[model samples]
Target: MSAPPDQGHVLVWQEPVQEAWIDYNGHLSEPYYVLVFGHATDNVMDAVGIGPDYREANDASLYTVEAHVRYLDEVSAGADLEVRSTVVGATGKLLWIWHEMWVDGRLRATEEILGVHVVGGGSAPFPDDIAARARELLVDPPEEASGRIRPLRRA
Candidate 1:
């Protein structure tokens, strides 16, 4: 899908909490949370016009260099999950994104991601059109995207 003309957050992906994804604790497993977030990232890539076809055509793609996820709540099986994503920023070869995962209208998780555009096995500038579209969708990062895991200080 092409980038939406609107310049704000977008609902990029949705899926149900599958039975197989449940853990012994009876909630969505930790890895599954990352899996869903990854799917949302892929959708965001598609929106910005760098999906599989683009990769195959140009031998270039966005490679996630770093990610930070906060799993805030439990998700039960069968719950419908949706991810809202924002293009926090983008440059010639780097993209920053924030995603919030929602279940039953409640915020369940958030992930901050940094991806680098790669061509021929090294970082490279994004194609002009793709960069333009990503810029059009850019928005300020949310409060949750502090880019740090909460500090751990114990007495």
Candidate 2:
């Protein structure tokens, strides 16, 4: 199948680094990287009708199965950063998403996340309605929006 549209529409979430999130090196800690990305994922899910309410109604939830993040720069304590995410790919119950951390329009990091649909506790196939909603939001980065990084690849 052909790739989805590279619309490059960035969903911006703003937050400042708290004292607890700082590391010995005087920057946001490594674990918080996933935390910020997780927040971004939740935003994207809400946009696509897969938020907590949807899960509660459908008896399904999306869980991250794998996440790969590359830290290109350091974010200092008290610094405000924005986390942006886009849907890269989706099929069956799996979704491949890409996220970036930005400070003042400069990219600080990039993350590739793989999420799976789950029911109760185990892996479960995506229902038709949810799949359709996700497909509607599946997006590709436009050439101008891609910047220096390549498009997200499937796992």
Candidate 3:
């Protein structure tokens, strides 16, 4: 139920695919994956002690400034999905988060985000403890972390 004491939390968000999330084409819609991955990012922020209390107390919160989502496969309504998040790294005010959405035992989508810490309406450094821990867990960003989504062109 929890990661070993030596390691930080293994961030995960699991939920059932909602019918309302399906689009007219009858598959999970592009925006819905963003919604689900957003939830996962919330969980990650909370686990790192940047949750509601932190915001209310410090007036600091993480804002996603950039995001890249890859729709790798299709998911249907009622399918079970899980999102796993990794802390890629952190600069003074920015934290990079990576998420993988899985369904039916396969990777369905991925989202990589640039998260900035804001305090009193301006970008600020992440707390020392959070930065240290996140840096420790940081690995090289995933291979897919590069590139933008674009229409496939003829090779």
lDDT by residue (53-133, candidate 1, tens digit) is: 999998988899889989899999888888888788787888887898888889999998888999989999988899888
TM agreement with the true structure for every prediction: 0.88, 0.80, 0.86
lDDT of 3 by residue, 45-119 (tens): 877778889889998899998898889999998898888887876777788888999897899999988888999
Name the regions of candidate 3 deviating beyond 4 angstroms. Answer: 1-9, 147-155
Best by TM-score: 1
Candidate 3: residue pairs that collide: none
Model 1: pairs clashing at backbone N, Cα or C within 3 Å: none
Task: Report the error of model 2 at residue 65, Å.
Answer: 1.0
Model 1: lowest-lDDT 10 consecutive positions: 146-155
Candidate number with the higher TM-score (1 or 3): 1
Q: Number of clashes in every candidate structure?
A: 0, 4, 0
Q: What lDDT does model 3 reach? A: 0.78
Each prediction's RMSD over C-alphas, in Å, is 6.1, 6.6, 6.5
Q: Which residues of candidate 2, in runs, are more than 4 Å off?
A: 1-9, 141-155
